[model samples]
Target: MSQDLLFQLNGVSKSFVKGKEEISIFSDLNLTIERGDFVAIMGPSGSGKTTLLNMLGGVDQPSGGEVSFDGARVDNLSESALTRWRAHNIGFIFQFYNLMPMLNAARNVELPLLLTKLSKAQRRKNVETALALVGLSDRAKHMPSEMSGGQQQRVAIARAIVSDPKLLLCDEPTGDLDRTTADEILEMLQLLNRDHGKTIVMVTHDPAAAKYANRTLHLDKGKFVQRELVA
Candidate 1:
C-alpha cells in the first residue's frame, strides 16, 4: 500500500469446504500490481484465475495473508465498507454482458450511479460520455436484444467504466463473441490501458488476448508459474 502500488497481495490464500473435503485454491501467493498496468492472468481450467480476480476486486476474502489497495487493507474491511469502496474504486467486466433487458443502453450504463449522490443531470452526462468513449453514442437507446453481441459487450464496458474507477477487473471479457468482434473489443481495451492509463487485471485463456497486455502472469496449480512482458 503505497503510491506506486495499486494492489499488493502478500501470501494470500483461500480455501473452500467442499462437502467433507477442503479445497485450497491459492497458498502463499504474492503479487503486486502497479498503477496503470495492464495485466493478464492466464491459467488452465480450475487453476484459480477467477478466484484471484474475485479476491482482488473485494468480492471474496483471503483466508490468510493480506490484500491491500492504496495503502488500505481491503481484506479486513467490513462487507458494507467493501461494497462502498468497490463502487468508487473498482469496475468489473464479465464474460457475459450483464445488462438489464428492460433498460436501454444508456440507462443500463447509468445504473451504477444510482448508488452515488450525483444529480440526475450529472448521471446522465456521465452515462453519455462513457457510451461515447466506447463508440456507442448512437446505440444509447437500443435495448440489449436490439444490438449484436459485440455491441452488448460494449455497453457492458461502458457500464463498467461509467463510474470512472481506478481499477478494472475483467473476466473473459471477449469470451462470447466472434473473432472479429473479439478483436475489436480487445483493441478498445488496449486503448483504455494505453490512452486512459486505467489499471486493468484481466483473465483470459486466449494467447492472442494476452498479447494486448503489458504483462502476463501465468498460474499453475494455484501458484505463479511464469511471468512475461510483451513489448
Candidate 2:
C-alpha cells in the first residue's frame, strides 16, 4: 500500500445463500482508495457498488479476505467495535436526506454527537460549524419539511460532516433534486473534496454527478473494470 492509501481491500468476496445455491456478488476483489481523494463508483444496479460501499463503511463484512481502512482491519472487527469505528470514522449521506422531519436542521446535525461525550454546548458549536461549512447556518432552526429539497440535502451533508469523519460515503445524494439543485449539491461536494481535503466515495449513476469526482471507478462482475479521470 502507498503512503496515502486510506482503504485497502484484498481478495474480498461477498455471497448470499439463496435457497439451494450461493449468489456471489463479487469475488477476489482488490481495490485501494487514497486519502483526500474524491472517488465515484459507477455501475448498473446489482453490480455490488453499494455492497462495496457498505463494506468500506463497516456496515457489511466480506465473506472472504480483508477490508482495511487507514491500516485498521475493518472486516475483522467485532460488531460492537465496527459500530464504534463507523460512528467515529465514517459519515453517511443517502438519497432521502434521512433527516427527522420533526427536528430542525441544527438538532438533526447534532444527532451523531449525541452518541459522544460532548456537552450540549460543544455539540451546538460543532453543529454551527458544520452548518456554516455547508452555507446553511441561517437555516439552523428550520425543520426538514420547511426547507426545499436542496436545503434539506445540504442539512444532510452538514450532518454527515459534523463529526469530521475520515471518510464520507454518499449514495445517490442528489437523486431527489432537480437538475439545478443537484448541480449545486455536487458543487458543494467538490468543494469539500478539493478545498477541505475530504476523502469521499460516492455511488452515483448520473454521469454528471460522477464528473465531480477526481476519479471514477466502473465496477462490473465484482471487479473494477475501468478507471476514468475527471480531475
Candidate 3:
C-alpha cells in the first residue's frame, strides 16, 4: 500500500454461505482511495457495490487479504473495536433516510454525540453547524413527517456529518428522490467534497449522479473493470 493512501484493499475477497453453497462476491480484489477523493462505484445489480462499500466503511469484514485505512488494518479489528473506530472515523449515508421518527432534526443530528465525551453545549453547537452546512438550519425543530423527502434526506446528511468523520460512504444517496430533488442533493454533496475536502465514496447506478464524482469506477461481476476520471 502507498503511504498516502487513505484506503487500501489488497487482494481482498468476500464470500457468504448460502444453504449448501458458498457464494463468492469478490476474489482477489484490489483498490486504493486517496485522501479527499470523491469516487463513485457503479455496477449492475448483484455486482457487490454495496458489499464493497460496507467493507470499506468497516461495517463488514473481508474473508481474505487485507483492508487498511490510514495505515491501520481495519479488517483485523474486533467487532466492538471496529464499531468504535467506525463511529469516530466513518460516516454512512444510506438510500433510505434513516432518521429517528420521534426525534426532531436537531436532536436526530445529535444522536452520534451520545457516544462522544462532548458536553451538551458542544454537542448542540456541532449539531447546529452541521444542519447549517446542509442548509437545514431553519428546519432544526421539524419532525421527519413534517418535511419533504428531500428535506428529510438533507437532515440525514446533517446527521452523518455532525460528528465530523474523516470518510463518508454513501449508498444510493439520491435513489428515493425525483430528478430535481436528487440534483439538489448531489450539488450539496459535491460542495461538501470540493469545499470541505471530505473524502467521499458513493455507490450509484445513475450516470448523471456519478458525474458529480471526481472519478467513476465501474465494477462488473464483483471486480473493478474500468475507471474514468471526470473533470
Candidate 4:
C-alpha cells in the first residue's frame, strides 16, 4: 500500500442476523482514502454509510475481507488493540455535540489526552491549543449548555482534534445547526483540510454539506452509485 493512503477497504462485507435471517448490508465494497483529502459520503437510510464510516474508524469490523489503515490491517485487531488504535489514529465528530454537560469546554477537550501519557501541564497546553484552533478559546470555561449550537459544535471539533489524530470521521457534523452556522462549521472543516492537513471523511445527507468536501460519493442499497469531484 502507498504511504499516502490513509484507509483501504477491500472486498468488505457486512451482515446482521435478524431472527434467523442473515441480512447483508454490503458485499465486495471497496474504497480508498488518501491522506489530507476531504471526502463526503451521501446515502439514504440503511445504505451502510455509517457502517462504512465505523469500519474505517475501527469502531466496527467487516464480516469479510480486509480493512487497512496506514498500511496495517485493522479489521483483524482485537477489541483492546482497536481501542488503543482508535484513540491514537481516529477523531470522530457526530451530528449531535456529544459533550458532557458538566464539563467545561477545556475539560471536555482534554478528555482524549487523559488516555495518553502526557502530563497535566502538557494536556492543558494541548487543550488550550485545540480550543484556540476552533476559535473557542474565550469560551473554554463555559459549559456546554452555556454556548450556542455552533459554539458547542466548535468545542466538539476542538475535542476531536486535541489528540492530533491522523483521521477525522465525521457523521453529519453540521446536521443539528442552522444554515449559516452549518456553513461556518463546514468552512472550518475546509480550513482544517486545506490549511492544517487534517484528512476528513464526513457522512452527510445534505448536498450543501457535501459541497464543502473535495470529493463526494453517493451510496445506495449498499453500493456506490456515483462519485463527483468538487472544484
lDDT of each: 0.94, 0.93, 0.93, 0.94
Local lDDT at 8 for model 1 = 95
RMSD of each: 0.9, 0.9, 0.9, 0.7
Write down the lDDT that model 3 would get. 0.93
lDDT per residue (tens digit) for residues 78-132 in model 1 = 9999999999999999899889999999999999999899999999999999999
Model 2 backbone overlap count = 0
Candidate 2 residue spans exceeding 4 A from truth:
none
Question: What does the lDDT come to for candidate 2?
Answer: 0.93
TM-score of decoy 3: 0.98
Write the residue-wise lDDT of candidate 2 on 110-190 in tens digits.
998998999999999999999999999899999999999999999999999999999999999998999999999999999
List the pairs of residues colliding in candidate 3.
Answer: none
In model 1, the runs with Cα more than 4 Å from the true position are: none
Once model 1 is optimally superposed onto the true structure by TM-score, how far is the C-alpha of residue 169 displaced, in angstroms?
Answer: 0.4
The C-alpha TM-scores of every prediction are 0.98, 0.97, 0.98, 0.99
